[model samples]
Target: MTTAIGNPYLEGNFAPVSDEVSVNDLPVTGTLPPELNGRYLRIGPSPKGSGETGMSHHWFVGQGMVHGVRLRDGHAEWYRNRFVRGDVPEDSPNTNILAHGGRLLALVEGGGAPVSITPDLNRMSTWDADGALRAGFTAHPKTDPATGEMHSLSYLIRPGTEELRYVVMDATGKATHAAELPVSGVPMVHDMAMTATRVVVLDLPVTLSMDAMGRLAAGAPESGDALPMRWNEEHPSRVGVLPRGGTADQIRWFDAPRCYVFHVLNAYDTPDGSIIMDVVRYDTVFRDVFRGPADGPPALARWTIAPDRGTVSEQIMSDYSVEWPRINQAWAGRSHRYGWFGGTGPDSLRLSDDVSRDRGGSFEPGPLVKFDTATGEASAHHFGTGRVTQEPTFVARPGAEAEDDGWILSVVYDGTADRSELVVLDAADLKAAPLARVHLPRRVPFGFHGNWIADNEIGA
Candidate 1:
């Protein structure tokens, strides 16, 4: 069964799977690494029932479903898919998943509480750090590798909410500090960046739209069932750099160039008192389509924010279009040498209106790219054609000292076979063939971020 006739997001690899099946002893094509002793879990919108269709159905509004692959003792142990059951299951966290603080968490942005799940991917309950999350948690949280504390910038999307919160969670997964930073508009804060001493807040141009809300409330045809956020040209784009646990008054604001950023690769503080950040940048989003992002083929860019001069210098790091940029978690909030991303094209950027007319792109699969930031050189591994690759999560080799000494795990969907496989590549050699491939029973739909939760990290 398919979704709305021409809704691209509801068709192809973006389509939702109806069954929640568990299959053990999956077939493996190559030798699995014995050290990969844990789970590779990914979560995304998998809408329930065929009742959801039409222009109102958006890509980001589907139910949360998690797809997991377990590896232990050099074997593909099992593969499972389960729904993140909630009071309103459709609104459950579906953007990212990770094991932190001794519990596995499914996460989302825009004022949603983290849904704690068992290590095996079953929903438990809404987690608020023993009731520390007053406003909610963000999908993207930066962990301080030096201190083991996780930090994020969270915001509630509403008609009158005019502030964003800076939250910190200790190594034990308890909410340690949270501060409400006042702002003029309720911006869509998808991700945040952190350094040794401060947290970077993105106050871009995309904001909550009351007009779209009124249209949806009145059941207008043009008002789709997506989040009501639009590109507010009047809203000034800026970045607030504040001390890790600092209050609003302590935040130093700088005017940023007009643009929107959905993901930050990494950030760190320089000796000159400037914050250096790398991010996937979009020119403008939510302008014509009320659904998901319909802007540029997002490019990797770097921003140098000088607090002393109160200015920001923006530089497009590469002309190559990409998304879901990731780095070594061990180097989080610090200088890094390598970054991995899924390649995209201009055809992938389309609006809902275009999708209805059969003009949207499927975000077709491109090469998996590895960027050498220090040398401005890149290498790629193309998985032929018609194979969609998601974000490449980097897992370092045990006791490895080099930054690129690791493996890159990504979920790739083979269109010809109508199935998916977990591809493991050597980070040091992107052009080389995959190290291993674990074949699965079904195609894991294109989705957002996830991680390699080792046994030690989860105490499993």
Candidate 2:
């Protein structure tokens, strides 16, 4: 079926310009790229400047705006203020550009890396209330899940210096706390994940010694080593879990192997007790290098965290790589179960792969696989090629529903003029052809994250 909807803001090429000027002292804001506008949410990449090289300029400020879109028809009726903002230096193309949260809790991040914070977007603008930018804050803020309050952490990087000075802010975007996190002579923080009570940071320690061959030959090493490792001190892929209201001394440390870069973590209460789905990028290098069978595939691992016992058990899921997996909102208060396409091995497609290559590089969308937590059975759907699918978002059928029954919504990038289509799949039997395919006029730009807002709660 086909339907046409008009975007008033998008109608006359009337693009929203960045209120802030560029780092280059230019008055013009870069193009307002078109992206998927969602109900109570919107995610897109805001470039720093104009032209091809502008897109390559990683230092450009990237913006992610989440607002309320009409659920009945995909039209943005109202918008929450821009929550996630960061300067993407050319080298760090993998930073997070997406933020996902609800009316009460919103999580914002800079690229895919770890500056994850919860922010409140449904408030009266400070400018509307106070009459000045001076009354406002400069840093992008995230919300604290435990307290349901907003907070922000700002960092300063000086020329020829590696340390990052940070300032934390309250809900009103006012600086409430401040500190400096030494990049240890490194450029920036790699990735981070958080829970209600703790902030987990994945800092990559800069290395001066060892050439490419020397580092690869040495493989992975512990913290304080010269090799390129995941969470080590020299390459500090270390995890610092600090209590929400506590001091740095209360931070707990954990070690990740050379190839494992931590992704997202979700707290779960299993029959065995509380555990966490500690997702990490496995067997992938941040830098572009030789691609061959030697490269390992990404995978996810489950870790049992018993705070009282102060013990952790690392149990790897046998067939799943730490690569990207489609995660749905947990049902029945259960932990999240991810679905995606591709084999769990060294050859798995990763985001870092070259997109223009004939082989279609690593980030190419693969098959559909569903993971069952209760059975631990990874089910593959319609294996092999045909429909190229990337990240898949899920929507529960309106009403109290069965666990296995819901609609799985995803954008299928068909690689041609009719570039993409929104396909709905049977959540229980993903192998079934799409229940519906909603065609689009233009290809929706590749996005990082999305969520489903039901009809009733929207347009209220």
Best by TM-score: 1
Backbone clash count for every predicted candidate, in the order shown: 0, 35
Per-residue C-alpha lDDT of model 2 across residues 335-396, encoded as one tens digit per residue: 55544433332233433554312221223335556666556776644433444554456565
Residue-by-residue lDDT tens digits, candidate 1, 1-460: 3555667777777788888999999999888878899999998988766444456666776678899999999999899998887545444888988877888988888888788888877546787788787467889988887777888888887888978888788999988888889987789999999988888899999988888778777877353446778899999999999999889889888999889999999998899999899998887877755556655457788999999999999988865667899998888888887899887652222222333223243344456888888988867777866776869999999999999998999998888888999999999999898989999989998778788888888888
**Candidate 1 local lDDT, residue 395:** 91
Using Cα atoms with residue i matched to residue i, what is each candidate's TM-score against the true structure?
Answer: 0.94, 0.57
Against the reference, the lDDT scores of all candidates come to 0.81, 0.39
Off by over 4 Å in 1: 49-52, 87-91, 221-225, 346-365
Give residue 413's error in model 1 in angstroms. Answer: 0.8
Query: Judged by lDDT, which candidate is best?
Result: 1
List all candidate RMSDs to the true structure: 3.2, 11.7
TM-score, candidate 1, is 0.94
Clashes of 1: 0
